[model samples]
Target: MTGTQPFVLAEQALLGALLLEPSRIDSVRPHLRPHHMYRPAHAALYRALLDRPPDPGLTMADRTMALVRDAGAHAAGITPVYAHTLMAACPRPRHALVYARMIVEAADHRLVREHAVRLGQVAAADHARDGLADTLTHHRHLHRVLDDLHRRRPDHDTATSTPAVPTPELNPEPPLPGNLDDEQALIGALILDPAPMSALSRWLTPADFADTAHATLYRCVHALVLRGEPVDSLTLAWEAQHQGAFAAGDGGLTPELVAHIATSGMPADVDYRARRVLRAYVLRTAASAAAAVGTHAGDPTLSTSRLVTAARTALTPLDDALARRHNAITATKAPFTHTPPTTTATPWCTGVATWPTTGPDPTNPTAAHGPRSGRRP
Candidate 1:
C-alpha cells in the first residue's frame, strides 16, 4: 500500500521483510528519489547525460552540456524513455532499481511497452542467478494469483484461449532424481516401463514409490510421455519442486525429466552456452542415427537432416529445452547435488545419524556414566 511496498512486492521479499520489520520501505528512499520535472529544461538536460554511458572524464558540467544538446529535441518530453531515464538515474542503486521497475510497471499499459520489456529483460551480461530468482519470484506469485482469479469464472462469450495456466495440477511433486547416468537409466525405464505404462490412470500411486521418490518421478514422467499431452514440463516440475520432491533423495531427475518432456514447446530455461552444447549433441546424435539407418534400406526416409529434425519435432520444443536446461545445470555443477535447501525443513540434518543409546546398554545395567548431556532438538 505504501510507495515502497510495490518494490518490495516486486522483489518477492516484501512479506518476509514485513515480517522482519514493517518499515522496510524506509530503506528504499535513497534509490527511488524522483526528479521534480516542473523545471523541464533543467530536468531534460540532467537526464540526457545520465541515461547513456558516461565518459569517466566528463565533469557534471560536461554531462549537463550534453543534456542541453539532446534537449533541442525537447529532452523532457514526458515520453516513456524520458520517464525511464529519470528513474534509472535516481542516484542511488536501490532507489534506481525501484524507479526502473516502476517505469516498467507503468509502461506495461502504454504503447511504449518496449520500454517495459527492455527494463525487465535479464541480459546475459547482467544476469545474476540471485537477481533473476528475485525478480522472477515476484512476477511468478503475481501471475499465480491472477490466474487463480481468472479461472474462477471464464468469459464464455470470449473466443480467446483460456488463460495460460501452464499446468493442470497444483503442487505437483517433482520427479525423483539421480545422477546423469541415473537420468539415463530413468529414461530407459520410461521406454520400457516393466509395470506397463498404460496402467498409470488405474494403478500408479504416490505411496508406491514412497521410499524411492526418484523412481516414482521416473514413472510419472513415463506416464506423461506416454500420453503425449500438450503442456509445459517446467510447470509440472514446479509441482514436484514445490512439494520438495525434486532432489535425488526426494524424487530426483525423474521429475525434472518429466518437466522437460511436458514443456516440449518452450526453450529449456537453460543458460545459452549450455543449451547450445545440448542442441549440438542432439543434432549430432540424430545425424548418426540417420546415417546408420541408411545402410539398412535405400535411405528409407532417413536423411540426417530429416532424422534429427524428426526427433526434435516429434516432441515439443520443451523437450530440447529440458535437455538444454539439464545441460545448463550440469555445465556448472555436478549431475546431482547432495540436497536441496528446502530439505533442511526435516528434523534430521546429518547423513549418517547414530541411534540413541538404549538405556545405557541393557547388558551393563550398572555401568554408571556421569551426567550425560541432553540431546538438543
Candidate 2:
C-alpha cells in the first residue's frame, strides 16, 4: 500500500469499530470529528454514525446493516457489502479508540502542514514587499495551530529524536546586487569610522552579512571596536587571522580587498546600510524558519508538543532579529544619552533599554503575554 493508504484504512477501521459497537461511539466522539476522516465517504459515514443510533431491537448483523443503510443516504458509495468489508477489515472492535486517535493524529499533521505552507508563502511575499508585519502574523498563526494540536494530543509521547534540519527551498529571487554592496558598505563605513559601532552594534550582527568572508570581517571589526583597539587594514587583517577567518586555499580577505573595504564608503550612511543588512537577515531568517517549521510538521515521529517546541526553537533567530530591528528604530528616535554607572549590569548596552529590565512591559500594547518576550514594539 502507498503511504496515505494506511490512513484510509484507519478511517475504515474506525467506522467499522463504531458500527460493530455503537455504544463505543462515545469513546471517539469527543475528540474525533467526522471531518477528520481522510476520505469524503468515510467522513459522511462517520457523521451518519453520530446522527443515527442503532435500533435497540436489532441483532448485531442487523444493526450493522441498518447503520450502513442510514449512512448510504448521506455517503454515496457506502453499501451493505462495503459495511461488511469494513467490519471484516477491523482487526479488533475493542481497539476503536486507538484507531480514532490515529485518524486524529493524521488530521493534525495535515492541518499543521497546510498552515506551514501558507506561512512559507507569506514569508516569500513579505520578502518581496520587504515587510516584517506579515511574517510576524503568519508565525503567530502557526504557533496557535500548534497550540491547538497540543490541546488535542495532551498525552502524546515526546521522546522522538531531534528532527533533521530541512533542506530549505531556494528563494526564487536572488539577493539584489545592491544587497551585497550594502553589506560591504556597512562594513566599510564602520572601518572608516568606528564611532557608529556603538549605535550599529545594538542591532547588526555578523550573521547579517550575505558573504561569509564579509561576515568574518565584520566580526573582526566589531570585536576591535568593542576592545577599543585601532581599526585599520593591518589590525583588521591580524584580527581575521587570529580568529581563523582565513582558510589556507580559499584566498580569503586578500590585502588589496581589505584596503578597498577600509578606504571606501561614507561613514554617515552607516545607519542606512545597517538597516539594509538587518532587513536582508530578517528575510533570510524568516525563510529558513518557515522551511524548518514545515519540515517539523511533516515528521510523523514528532509528537504535538515536540513539534511546537521544535518550531518555536527554529523561529527564535528570526524573532530576535525582528526585536532588535524594532529596538534599533526606537533607539534612533529617542535622544542619545550617556551610559549610567550602575552596580547592576544589563544584558544589552544601548543608550535606551532595548529589552525589559524587570518584566514584560504591560503598557506596551504589542508586547507578548509572557515574561519579557522579545516581541516587536
Candidate 3:
C-alpha cells in the first residue's frame, strides 16, 4: 500500500495539470484514462476533463464547478473545492504526460498484484484439496490468467481508430506438474558451480522452465556458461539487469531469489534434476498437442487425416527422445563380427551336359540319333 502512495499523488498531479491547461489533455489522453487513477474522485475529474468541449468558452474554474455539480460530487462527499485544491497544487502543467505515465504504470502494477493474490489463493485451495484433476484445472486457469496479464495491450491512440481483429485462443493445456524446487536447485547449483553446465545442458535448456523469470535467469546462465564466464549471484544479477529482464515490475531474476534457490535444496543431484525438468517440458508439450487435437477434432473443416497427422506430430517429441536414448545405448554396446565357414560346400548345378549336339554322335558306331533314340545325347 505504501508503494502505491506515489501513484495517488501522480494521479492528483495529472488531473490538476489537465484542469489547469485543458490543451495538454490531448498529450496525456493517449497514455491514460479515468480508470487509471487510483482514487474515484480523481477518476471522476479525469472524466470531466475528457468530456469537456475542445473550445469551451467558460473559464477553467467555472467549467470545473459546472462538471462537479453535474456529476453530483457533493452527494458523493467530493466537492468542487477539492478540484480547485488539486489544480492549484500542480507544480507544472507541462509534466502532465509524465504524471499520466506514472498513473498508468501504477494501474498495471495493481492489476498484476491483484491477479497474483488471486492466483496464490487458488493454488492454496488446490493444495488443500489435493485432487489431481482439480489441481490440473487450477493450473490451467492460472496459466490463462498469467497469459492475460502478460499479454501486451494495444496502444490507446491507435486502438481507438483501428478495426478490431480476432486472435486465435492460446492452447488451454496446462504445463505438466513439475518439481520447481528441483528445477531451482539445479539452476542454483549450476550457478554455484559451472562445472556441471556441460552435462546438464544436454538434458535441459532455458525453454524447459515453466516460470518466465526462471527461464530468463536460466537463459542468462546458459549464455554465461557458453561464453566460459563465471555464473554466480552477482554475475547472474548483472546479466539480468543488463538484459532488461528486471525492468518490468514483476518477479524477476534477482540476487536474493538466486541465493534463496541456491540454499533451498541440494545441488548435488543436478543431472537428475535436469532430467526431471526435461521430462516435465516433454509432458507439457505432449499435453498441449493432445489438447489441440481434441479441440480441432470436431471441426467440420478439418479432415480426419490431418487430425491424425497433427496428433502424431504432437507426440513425436517423446518418440524422438526415446529413439535418441536407444541409439546412444546401441552406440555404447560391443560391436558384432561375422565368422566364415571352416569347410567349402559343393557348388549347386542343374543336371545338364555342357557339350554341343550335332544330330547324333556320328563317330559312335551304335549311336541312335535325334528323336528316334533317347541315348546319351
Which candidate leads in lDDT?
2
Q: What digit string (tens of lDDT, one per residue) describes model 2 on residues 1-377?
A: 44656668888898888877888888788988987987888888898888877567888778766667777777788888888788888989999998988888778777877877777787778777767677778778887887777675776553455454444444433455667888888888777666566556667777677777778787777665554455677778877776766654123666667777887856657777888888877777777777777787787776556666777777777789889888889877887542322223223322222222343332232331234423223
TM-scores for every candidate against the unseen true structure? 0.18, 0.77, 0.39
lDDT (tens digit, per residue) of candidate 3 on 91-128: 89899887877676666555433443443344344434
Taking all chains together, the TM-score of candidate 1 against the true structure is 0.18
lDDT of each: 0.33, 0.71, 0.55
**Predicted candidate 1 versus true structure: per-residue lDDT over 1-377, tens digit per residue:** 44643432333232122112223334533332225222444344434434444455766445434544575466444443443344343344434334434432322222112221232342111232212333233323323433442343223332253222121112212222222333333334433321222222122222223235534454444333332211134434643454455654463445555645443323222223223323333332222322222221122222222322232232222234334444455544544222211212112112312233322221221321222243223
Please report, as a residue range, the 10-residue window in candidate 2 with the lowest summed lDDT.
345-354
Q: Worst 10-residue stretch by lDDT in candidate 3? A: 340-349
lDDT (Cα) of model 3: 0.55
- Provide the global lDDT of candidate 2 against the true structure: 0.71
Assess candidate 3 and give its TM-score to the true structure: 0.39
Question: Which stretches of model 1 miss by more than 4 angstroms?
Answer: 1-132, 138-186, 189-377
